[model samples]
Target: MHIHASLRFPRRLVDRRLLLSLSLAGFFVVHSTHAASFDCSKATTAIEHAICDNETLSQLDSTLNEKYQTAMANLSDEGASELRKNQRSWLKERDACNADAACLENLFNQRKSSLQATTQQAETQLDAIIASIPADPANAAYQLKQYRGPLASAWLVYLNRFEPTSGVTAEEAKQRHQVAVTALNKQNDFAASLLKDIENDPKTSKNVAVLTFLRMTIEQGRYDEVPPRPDVHCFVFSRQGDAAYRAFGALWGSSRDSQAPICPPQGNLFELPAWKQLNKILDPVMSAAYPNSGTIRYASYADWAILRLRATLSPTDFLKPIEGQSQESPEKRISEWDDKSWPKVQREQLLIAIDPARKATMEWLQTERKFTASDASKASTAIVNAWLNEQLDYLSENLSTGDQ
Candidate 1:
């Protein structure tokens, strides 16, 4: 489907200054207007005292801090680390000019100019990289490695937000997440501005929204924070249709009868084209993953969504004829599926049903989901039971959901 043709986004006027101020608020680790970057009450060194004592120097320090943070935000991990190291080295040199306002001002100006230049260069490179991206919704996370700098690093955290950090206490994990949040917060202004621009551009808006929805779905499991607008629904349904549908029926969460597998909320995303796409990837999408409370399939969210959507749209596709049963009635198929006696032979039927797209799904599993050949070949049996339970549970719900 032509995503742009199907979706329309409402334009929003962004106040760049407000965004910048918000970014600044989030940028500083320590909130202080007097010293700007650090607290003056704890000022120890002569350099710190000198800056705190003089309003002009303090303002220069604050201005330089902004530029320094902006440069760090756009730089790669190695680049940001190097910048930090350089800043520390510069601090030592600046200390030598203790209480010398003229020297301090010169050094601050030069550092500010250098940071501005660095930020400009990094932004230029990042913008080119973003422009080159194809805006495709499938396998969005795979495109992440192509990014670099702190922005890239922040994305790394975002994409892998659910991954377990070995041997870390819960507190440690929380601390690490806070660190990641701090890093991403620095780019809030830039991200806000970019989103505003995307919302205003009709041609690229839906494509960008689809890409963003896919990425966020993989990252956060749901983009519920966004309003339930028509274009938003279009893009989300295009990528994670099944999950959206299941979510719409209120099938997820703690409800005991909620047979729908855990997925991102759909928010009125049911549409024919989106449902057809879900039908296309039904098996692997269904066989892909089973998310429980506080658990997710990670990058496989899209695949799972497709399967769930397909099941919702066409449950008959999941009902396979038993072996040696030459003529099966709809009653028999429903009875067997309901009895949970749906044979393992039905798995073979699924293979046949999905034969045409088996290769495509296999490649997606192996590449996008990093599934091994063996696992991908079987369309991932790790969650077959989850799929079965989902089928049984959701079928029992008596939902009248499908593309009508």
Candidate 2:
């Protein structure tokens, strides 16, 4: 994707042409006395003046022809044709390039805005942490306040030394610096609260717990420098209290069938039987992992469907579901030929498999002696991991069989 502009033009051709033209003019001016002293004013007519200028004009023309011949001699017929084709293609490409540049500019602007918003949110949360810090003499909060400034300063120094330049405007840099300052101030406040929590009631220290979570979250965020997968993080977090996660899971699950079927009948090869066999093995393992969640169930079902679809469909069709989902638009009813339909189908298939397991798991959790938020989160994480592992195993086994 990195483009070097210097490679586009032939510098040698330009250099040669410039040198040749100057040499020709210099030779005529130095060697020919009549050429150099041709008096246009005493010619008495425009045609005579023009005639007097012929020697200079002839030299210029000869130099140009030589340059042209040299350039042509170096080009193959195919290369010449390709060059012409590319020139024609460049007309369309120029507009596309401009549009792409505009899009990147907009994306950069949006990222700056998002960064500012995120920093503000973190600052607000940090302020709350500070306000919550108790003023007890033995409080960790008191000690934290004393050391927070130095820690924040050290962090800022590290960031300044190591972070890559973003090529942002001066105003943007100022805003980003302000955001960092705000974040640092908030961290100081949070540190004070952590100290207080430790001194008072260590068992129910929500502040300390949240701080630990945030530290882990920030560390993970740092690793995700490339085009991020924040959706996965959001989805995992939603299992705690976010209704949007459930909605997304439902939508994601429901859309699976609309994806291309794994085991569609094709010329001399029907993979339906093998797909069913694989599904039978996958079903129990998935059920154990995701006993009460439609999300995992749906995802597992889709995985199985993809395996079946791959057997009968071309590689292109196997890729179609992923491609179709990428188009962010309103969902439509499932149709036979519509690529978007596969996701819906896959989701439906997942729901059918997952709904029972989810109900059973919920019942089991309700009967447990200690059903706290932490316990629920742990359970969810365990289930998600198990489901992922089961699906991976099923896919691997089916792929090996299919290859054979």
Candidate 3:
């Protein structure tokens, strides 16, 4: 459910919708004395003449005229002038269809749909704004301002990209839901964290308002359920291609150098010095290729990166010498997502899907073979946060960044 910016539409669409909006609002007022949108006695064109002769069309024309007159009177002087100019121009073009009933009907429908009433336009604005909000807590306060408008009942409709998804069998849907549960749970936790941050703010009233509107949707049964999260769709290293490989290679100046086994990625990637640089390279490639990619991307990166690093430096360079339960071996950790199946070419990489939060399933895959709930929780947070910070920052830039 991508909501493209309405303002980005073509010029014709904007013009047609403007006419349609005015037409719908004023079309059926049923003014008998004023029976046409224009002066009937002066009508000359075949289409204009046809409208004056037909009772039904003459009624519709009068309705459009009523709306047009009211709108023009309320508009600013410049706006009224502009409308007058555009309408005159449009009438000329419209009349070219003459008495072609199909063309005339099509024209009416196009404008009507294009020009939603004031209320519908406002609701659409809310959806576009809410959907574009940053997933990070830092931007929550600024983004919450958009929730000020009345939340349209339609806004509550399910925003999930997965449900109503066709072609998947019941078992597959169940599995996908299972994988999504963790993410959904994580999203709920994140939302709670943001609410807490908002509460600590000096302006609690403003924050509460945003939450109230969101709750309205739930109560109205627009969304299927709370805890919004997407299903895990692929392995961490699942995405790779010549285009992706090119972006990866560009991380280093030369292709050969980028592919030449380098361990521990040249520098810190998620934060500080390398953060901005990494985002510049990763954002476009991710958007064009793996827009839906998630936690797996970061985890898989660690795997292959460590695999390459093992080529030169000792893998032990990566770990702490802590005892038993807490101790981490770089070799063992890398083995969690990789094995002999590692591909020579990234394009040929094999991907297997597994729920990252499912402790039992992950344990069976031998990832740290015996991760306790506490241990797994700590590991998941650390890895996921690293991934999320990069994601949030990238999203902040890539999403509709304008203040609309």
Q: Highest lDDT among the candidates is held by which one?
A: 1
Off by over 4 Å in 1: 1-33, 135-150, 153-404
Q: Give the whole-model CA lDDT for all candidates, comma-separated.
A: 0.44, 0.33, 0.35
lDDT tens readout by residue for model 2, 349-394 = 5435443443333333334423354453444333323333345443
Error of 2 at 326 (Å): 21
Question: How does candidate 1 score on lDDT?
Answer: 0.44
User: Per-residue alpha-carbon lDDT of model 1 for 1-404, expressed as tens digits?
Assistant: 00122122222323555575788888775654466467888899888888988888998999998788767756656677888999999888888897798999999889889887887787665544433333521133334344343444333343343223222234543443344444434534333344344435555433344334233222221123233111222333333433333222221122211222234423222233432343443433234323222222221233345444443333332334211112322223333442132344543454354333445544545665566787665642222322333343333332232111
For all predicted structures, in order, the TM-scores are 0.35, 0.19, 0.21
Which residue pairs in candidate 3 have backbone atoms (N, alpha carbon, C) closer than 3 angstroms, thus clashing? 20-111, 236-296, 263-309
Q: Give the winner by TM-score: 1 or 3.
A: 1
Candidate 3, position 69, lDDT: 46
- Point out where model 2 deviates above 4 Å: 1-138, 150-339, 343-345, 367-404
Worst 10 residues of 1 by lDDT: 1-10
